[model samples]
Target chain A: MRAWESNIRKVVPYVPGEQPKGDRLIKLNTNENPYPPAPGVAEALKHMDIDRFRKYPDPTASDLVHALAEYYGVGDDQVFVGVGSDDVIAMSFLTFFNSEKPVLFPDVSYSFYKVWADLFAIPYETPALDANFCIHPEDYYRENGGVIFPNPNAPTGLLLSLEAVEDMIRHNQDVVVIVDEAYIDFGGKSALELIKKYENLLVVQTFSKSRSMAGMRIGFAIGHPDLIKALNDVKYSYNSYTMNMPSLILGTETVKDDVYFKETVQKIIDTREWSKTRLTELGFTFPDSMSNFIFASHNRVSAKELFEALKKQQIYVRYFDQPRLSNYLRISIGTREEMEALFAFLEKYLAQ
Target chain B: MRAWESNIRKVVPYVPGEQPKGDRLIKLNTNENPYPPAPGVAEALKHMDIDRFRKYPDPTASDLVHALAEYYGVGDDQVFVGVGSDDVIAMSFLTFFNSEKPVLFPDVSYSFYKVWADLFAIPYETPALDANFCIHPEDYYRENGGVIFPNPNAPTGLLLSLEAVEDMIRHNQDVVVIVDEAYIDFGGKSALELIKKYENLLVVQTFSKSRSMAGMRIGFAIGHPDLIKALNDVKYSYNSYTMNMPSLILGTETVKDDVYFKETVQKIIDTREWSKTRLTELGFTFPDSMSNFIFASHNRVSAKELFEALKKQQIYVRYFDQPRLSNYLRISIGTREEMEALFAFLEKYLAQ
Candidate 1:
């Protein structure tokens, strides 16, 4: 190893759910939407002026930002766009959490939080989630440099209520509070409504989920203009063209088609509800899920056994090997046909 | 304005040239390719499966990386792709220049270097270019944490010979030496040949200038497997899916068609050469430029005055208002008709 290598802070990165190659596998691991994006997105792609790529895309992505602002009913300056929610959150960590005190987050929330903190050498502490995999608003009331967590927490589709989120932000007024709503459109209300009440609140969301455009990598942040300005300062110092033209063009089209977005989201929510009842009858236990995925533990079969068994039959679901989550499986709500195939396998394997 | 704002290192970011909206003007501010990308790119965009965006893109970007490796005759592990060269160089700075020692670069080189240094808290020193705006290889022999400068440096377009570049890297063997080759294809040999011999050398290039894909935001860095590993480690920790699928798919098509790349680059070079002679005849003086853009100062008119005059006619070119560059204009070489129009305007204005 090179001597200079020591300068890099050691970090164990967060590994996302496996993206199975080819269409043979009934993939349901990463919470991708089961429906295609808005029809306008496809139409926009079809008629794209490919020659426009010869010039640089607008750094601010003004048209997309304006579309997002109009859709959300916020001021134009209140919105900020990036490559995806991952990028928006990473930039927020760099811009806001600079104090010597440790930042607070749920130990079982999105695992990328700690990775970013370690990468930037910022102090952070992950307070354990409650035994039921729910966030306790009181846990974040104490002093910290900043705070962040997914609303409908990953790997455990439990969402914190809007009132509880506001309580947490209200208590931590001195520091920035970033509420990641990557899955909010599935059911829960967004923290966007709370931004004006609390200046430090930043609500982060993405087109990767409800809008079904993860491959395009479009995400955004909504907050007070001052906070957006700070994020912009850091972003401009970093890569100015984080959002490419295709993402900006198609993302705007997707944002403008509210009817298609709502219809598709309602379908996923319905599918999630139906899957919850079927998994219960199959002897699985989980908190009531508010997201497109359900986090459940089989009453009889070990998660590892079920994970491997499904893989053998070309079905994919996320199984965590980490502590407190070893017995849990996060199953994304796929099309009705895909879910039916999953339960058919479960009925034979877990004869309980 | 805020108490925590003091923690962020204050920096004035590099402002890229304006991307004029509407097709009513002749655009050439940034050094973007003046021609459309290879025909394959348009074909790929036409046939792109918009429905494929339901899932996340491949994090590794295998196809594009392999294509780039094959084209450069390097192993796949020797290449690392990112959003753009700005991103590649920014990541390089964060990964390699972590030592307390100051890095070395030219004072009048790409202005983004200092902005990145300040943003990341890396100490850097800019040694003045020689009287003719040429990099003196001996100036880089001194001890520093790292070294990075464009081959044909920005705002000047004067190239340092490959031998001179090799000497600088050899002397600074302990530190990483990055050769920014954003304009190398216009008319300069690359430092890609030095990677196998020097493990610390990194050659950063972009499709923005050479391949006419600036709007897609594709750039790459080439080096030894060890250096690539270090960059990958930081990248995985930062954002795994840095390159979107459209870019990954379309960039591969561009790299495979080397003939189109050569034709477009040669066309720009010929236009640049002819433009240089005309500017010289009009009493404009500049070092011999081997890049797609020229850095020239006219004896008869102030650059700011000419910049406004050009803008009045909707002819755009980059004009820097910084120290020592206030009097110089960096004109991007556009199509033949566009350049002729520029000269036609200049001929009349200079006669005054």
Candidate 2:
């Protein structure tokens, strides 16, 4: 590796879901919201005083942090914002994990956690998820530097209960336990309330999925004041103005408009339930997911073949090449119309 | 430190210039453009289709890169964009500098370079600038892993000639030499053209200074394809889609509008020249600047005293605590009206 840093060469980078171009496809990947953000968000962006953008944005993202704190019923000191949840996670790794002690995470959860651990040269332990793809709380009680997992874990879409999250945090009092609630708005209780009780709990969320602002790139974490301070220190040391002005303004407005969030999330949940029922009827076996996506596989059709077949029909879905979950396809929940179109394409492709 | 990474504890972060609040003051710090971005930038941002923000931004920022490539007269493959030029520099440290070989840069250049080097754990040697506060290219030709310096460099607005840059690159063929042209548009030659000849040359520029999009946070580098590929690999391993949607569109439009860029740079340069002459006539000693700011001090006034005096007059200027530079104040080139007000206040203060 030409004498590069040992960590840089050894890093296994995180691969985000494919974002293919062209408007001619029924795209059901990356778990992005099918609908646009709230009307208030667009209006906020439209009315942004571009003249003020010449000034550097507030390093604290003060207004957005205040808005999130009020919404989550936590004090402002409990919150921290970044470019996105990915940035928040990166900051967390730098803050908590070290070369000496290994951080712990679920084996089949968000892939980025492992990548970040490697990039930071932090030793890590990936405790296997049980056969049904559930995270056991007791496994995390062991000695480790920190713990992180997507609540409604990616790929599997299986969620750990808030009680389980509390158990892990309570037992692992000396280490930071981060709950990445990127998809919690779709389902699952947020561990935000646990911040008051557990100094080690850091709940991370993003505007990308349920808020439908992936292109905007804003995310935040809620934790005890000490934990938040550690992250802020790392962020300031790295990049001061991590969140841009437009994202900050739009993110603040998105949090303020609770009505839009509730309505949009309800619609996605409805569509997800309907899609799961239809897939079951078609003899597809998958986890009963809490997130805005489903993990499924058909008995006769291989996931790889089905993925290719759908691609030929101009319908896109995500298929993993990793072991344990290689046979399943992770399908994002789209709008009712897009889901109907996907079913129609599947019917034709299956018959062929 | 409770099992935290050793490197995390050792990081002494970079401090960005102050972003003062309230609109009552004549803000001249932070080297921000006194003017808003081009009219087209505001228009592009105002009419942004929020729905487009739901999908991920172009991971490679191809459209922005292409537009920048065209403006800089380089191939798209020769360009790399990041969250800011700081991000680009950070990525460069990861890609080009090896831990075994020490990196080299000016001791008085961008402070963030040292921070990046430290964060990456890359050993670096800060070659001292001459007593005149000028960067001699020959100094960087010494054996090192890589070298970088801001042209029209920060704190002191001195610049190096393109010939000197070419000489340095010619001599240091084994190391990557980056010319950070952050303020090049003010009145300095960009080394972008040399990328075709010197494969080791990397030219980094930002939309923050001339284009007035600091709030949007976009910066880019023009380099050989291999160097660009290395940056991309590091970026992908870090956080893909570093630039958000509004920045991509606005930055692309701003880069293409060369007329606006030229006019803005001319206005700032003219203001800087006018301010320098006025300061000199008032018995202020300062370097002849080639950038959008003036660095000067009066024999009668301590830099800190002058800073506080100006603050009392609702005018803000940057003052650093670093050795040799502490006696001077760095004042950003504001609009003609703002500079006149500053001059009026200084005249009254100096007379007293």
Best candidate according to TM-score: 1
TM-score for chain B considered on its own, for each of the candidates: 0.98, 0.97
| Per-residue C-alpha lDDT of model 1 across residues A1-352, encoded as one tens digit per residue | 6654544445564565577797778988888898888999899999999889998999989999999999999988999999889899998998888889889999998878988998889998888888898889998888889999998888788888999999999898888899999989888989999998998889999988888998999889999998888888889998889888898899999998999999999989988899989999999999888888999998888999999999999999998898999999889999999999999999988874
* Segments in model 1 whose C-alpha atoms lie over 4 Å from true places: A3-9, A13-16, B1-9
Look at candidate 2 and tell me the lDDT of residue A185. 91
DockQ of each: 0.66, 0.51
Which residue pairs clash within candidate 2? A98-B5
Per-residue error at B6 for model 1, in Å? 4.9
Put down candidate 2 lDDT per residue, B302-339, tens digits, no spaces. 99899999988779999988798899999999999999
lDDT of 1: 0.89
Worst 10 residues of 1 chain A by lDDT: A4-13
